[model samples]
Target: MATSTNGAPSMFSKSNYTWMLIGAVVIALGMFLMSGGKSADPNVFNRDAVYSTTRITVAPIIIFIGLAIEIYAIFKRSSPEKK
Candidate 1:
């Protein structure tokens, strides 16, 4: 059981950090999917682009899944051996 310089023990295990990183990436991907609904011509409105299924439904679902992952990571217990 290695300790930090402060010697208070680490708060998170390797797996927790890995899960957190994965969740962050998923959230970022969701945000990316929800982006870019701009029209090439400023005078014209692109209804389909703004209201696409990917942006409206899939993106939100992905974002929620990412959030759930993050919550799980935070509450996840580390193995006794790892500690």
Candidate 2:
């Protein structure tokens, strides 16, 4: 094994990983909100259930917000350590 003198830093810091986790959770929440609300009878077509505001409107918006959070996390830089 060769001894190395140069110290290398990781691409992402702990805060970045935490932000990623938060974003992932938010996305999952959005997906969960969008999931089906099964009617008691499959034969009966429930337009209201199918196109509810939460699933159609709110969920997509939430997902977009999560995506934005993820983007922010990816671009955010940690402050350099003071000497």
Candidate 3:
């Protein structure tokens, strides 16, 4: 929608907000999978398994960062404050 004569666009637009929420959830799930929901085992001796676990261990932190970025984008797109 176009901005009102006063110059700021509506803050309640559904598209941007909806996409932001969807993106956050997708990121969370992706991170969970990356960390290995049911397949991760620390005791496995195979080289590939060991490497996978190592990557899995770092998934949460990466997810947190992704969440932060998504939130930041939402805030950045917020309507300008009226004076």
Give TM per candidate: 0.91, 0.84, 0.39
Off by over 4 Å in 1: none
Predicted candidate 1 versus true structure: per-residue lDDT over 4-82, tens digit per residue: 5798778788888999999999999999999999999999999999999999999999999999999999999877654
Tens digit of lDDT per residue, candidate 2, span 1-83? 11224656666666777898899999999999999978999899899998999999999999999999899888888766556
How many residue pairs clash in all the candidates, one count each?
Answer: 0, 0, 0
Q: Give the candidate order by descending TM-score.
A: 1, 2, 3
Could you tell me how far off, in angstroms, the CA of residue 49 lies in candidate 3 after the best superposition? 1.9
Q: Candidate 2: deviation at residue 23, Å?
A: 0.6
Stretches off by above 4 angstroms in model 3 are: 1-12, 37-43, 53-69, 76-83
lDDT of each: 0.91, 0.85, 0.61
For residues 11-81, could you state the per-residue lDDT of candidate 3 as single tens digits?
A: 54555567677768867775665753344555555656436754555666667766876776566554454
> Whole-model lDDT, candidate 1?
0.91
Instruction: Record all residue pairs in model 2 with backbone atoms less than 3 Å apart, i.e. clashing.
Output: none
State the RMSD for candidate 1. 1.7
Determine which window of 10 residues in candidate 1 has minimal summed lDDT: 1-10
Preferred candidate (TM-score higher): 1 or 3: 1
